[model samples]
Target: MNDATTSPADSALATRGAALDLLFNVLAKRVPFDDAWDASRPLRALEPRDRAFVRMLVATTLRRLGQIDAAIQGSLNKQGQQLKAVVQDILRLGAAQLLFLGTPAHAAVDTAVELAVARKQHPYKGLINAVLRRLDRERASILAEQDAGRLNTPDWLWLSWRKTYGTALTRAIVETHLGEAPLDITVKANAAAWAERLEATVLPTGSLRRAAGGQVTELSGFDEGGWWVQDAAAAIPARLFGDLAGRDAIDLCAAPGGKTAQLAAAGAQVIAVDRSEKRLVRLSENMARLGLGARVTTVAADATEWRPDAVVDAVLLDAPCSATGTIRRHPDVARLKSEEDVEKLGRIQSRLLYRAVDMLKPGGTLVYCTCSLQAEEGESQITNLLYRRPEMQVVPVTADEVGGLSELLTPDGYVRCTPGHLAEIGGMDGFFAARLRRVG
Candidate 1:
């Protein structure tokens, strides 16, 4: 092939190489991949298009990690040994492009070989070329008979899901996670009006749905502060507070505040409390863009350690949890989390909920919420809190409060959404929320 035609693919592979090197380095140092991506100074230095390409490769590879690893193994040396993790990442990226992304075989192999040579790993380039060429030859047979679950998830995680959710639900959940998440936005006012302005579709819950990709700031009405990005289900807990006009509301652990904005927009005087100043910086920026900054009181302090000046009319504690519920939108969640981590977060969540109740006014509303699908972090934690705080009575949410989320309510009126709940019309991120009122 001529130099011009060959250069683009070579450049794309180099970008992939840099991204994988960065990913493996961070992962080896025990950094969470999402945090690593956010903290990557090198990745940030690249052009926006190059950054997008690298992010796409990394994200897609991780989403189909199990399959990518399998493909690499199947294309390995006769010794049955795999390449080093760094080289393996390169091969996986190449495999992902060729098999899944439909990039031409010549481009994928040629560029991957070029990348290997550039890295001074020249000897391995022939191996990469041979295996990838073999993969191209056997693409149909390899893909057709492949078991999706075995090829898409780590064995332990797969086994855990099988035992926890049973066969059918686990399969469906895993399959749902494979697709790109839809972009759902919450508007300050009418969803229909904002949808028309943004040229997006309005969902049943009044969230504006747009197909994925694009710079969020470039979208129309973004500069005008017309709406904010929020999962449809995530918008429920704030709404369940129900007409907070002229009320005093405390949003605990409220950094990078979506629910806080929801409250502020509904006319509540909001105290947004969070421990991290860095996170609160983003929250403050969002508030400014949305024009809700004037309504919010930003407090950088731990929720458990810091006491409010006085009791508020309402409290919304969107406690930190395993965050497994957001996996579809953030597939890196799976790579970073473990079951033991979930237990630790559940303990912390329980503590925060108890502290939030102590800060609520007598007979005032307190909404406890988590973006977690695990029962231990959601229902179990809430159930334990109820037993300890008898004066706190469940103030069941009415159908009207949730808009179209009536079907997601528990028998006692708590809100729960899962991968299984809304799979057809663009599934929702899982969440658990309960409304309680202090009786004494």
Candidate 2:
């Protein structure tokens, strides 16, 4: 009955337990879900198939956490007796598998009890079994009765979205977050060729999107380094520059450098800088893989404090912000980020933008962007920057330049891609990018 029984199924159950542990790290300890995943010894021991399953278990649990909790509370009655934390996480893992991931009821319940017993919460095994069994049996009715979007989203994010995008769009945005995002990649050349080979669709924004999920590293062109994974929306900021051939550009705060690769692909002599040496190492590795290391120079320095030797022809400042726009891909953002975090990030963004402006040559192009939905970090940041520096003006992005993604363009010509914009195409991450020209 114990996990050490050496059965293949029990070995699989251990993967589910690992997922629950990751959930505790994110929800209770406030560690980034990805960081927890990266540090998982259990995951490394599993085959690639089971490793993917563990990732699915954690992501599905977080993405539907509110609904899972509501289901638990409903099963427990209105009395409000709280279960122990470990027991609750085990139950959530079971519920997610049953209700959302098409796991059979018996397997779901059995795994919940097994994980509970394994983790020394044997006292709650019977209770967990009862609740999960009830939930599985009534999964349809329970799910239908709930307002999943409202229940799943934290209140602060809900209010922020409503205030910034209004009620209708806010609902749409949250609805989109419930779905999994497709894999999008930017190719070194011959996008159409790569799309055909990869069985992907070429997006209007020039990135190829793969809806059928698989191991990205296994895909063609991955080992060859002919392409790199970049979200379709995230690819827009780098493309704002029409031509960077032989031009000098600085990618500030650029680690895990997709944008830097794009700039280098465009023939820009790129100086990619970030404060984290570890991140810079990854960036360098990625650049080497893409055959772009020769075009880029790496520097590990705090972009806020570091300055280029002279003004560059172009500067891409992907400022740090509460990455609220990426909820679909990083469902933990809804649980991990807070309103205070947004305000704090806004100040940091301001400082980075000011420094970016200072580093730009007169008439040099500066692209300021963030994977954030809050106006404080995106629209308002630009407004404040313009008000303070009269010399800089918004350089309107055109529909033609971004492969006809005109709907994502704001009235003032800044590129603002929301989750709702490309819903028909599996949706892209919400992002805001503004190209500015330094006239003074």
- Say which candidate scores most in TM-score: 2
TM-score of each: 0.93, 0.96
For candidate 1, list the clashing residue pairs, or say none: 67-151
- Candidate 1 lDDT at 59 equals 75
lDDT of 1: 0.81
Candidate 2 lDDT over 1-440, as tens digits, reads 23344677777677787788789999999999889999888777676777888898889999999999999889985458788888888888998998899988888888888888788888887799889988988999999999998988999999989998889888888999999999999998999999999999998888999874877889987889999999999999999987999999999999999999999999999999999999999999999999999999999998889988889999999988889999999999999999999999999999999999999889999999999998899989999999999999998999897888688888999988889878877888999999999997
lDDT agreement with native, every candidate = 0.81, 0.90
Residue-level lDDT tens digits of model 1 in 153-178? 65555676677567887686677777
The clash count for each model shown is: 1, 0
97: Cα error in model 1, Å: 0.9
- Against the true structure, candidate 2 reaches a TM-score of 0.96
Pairs in steric clash, model 2 = none
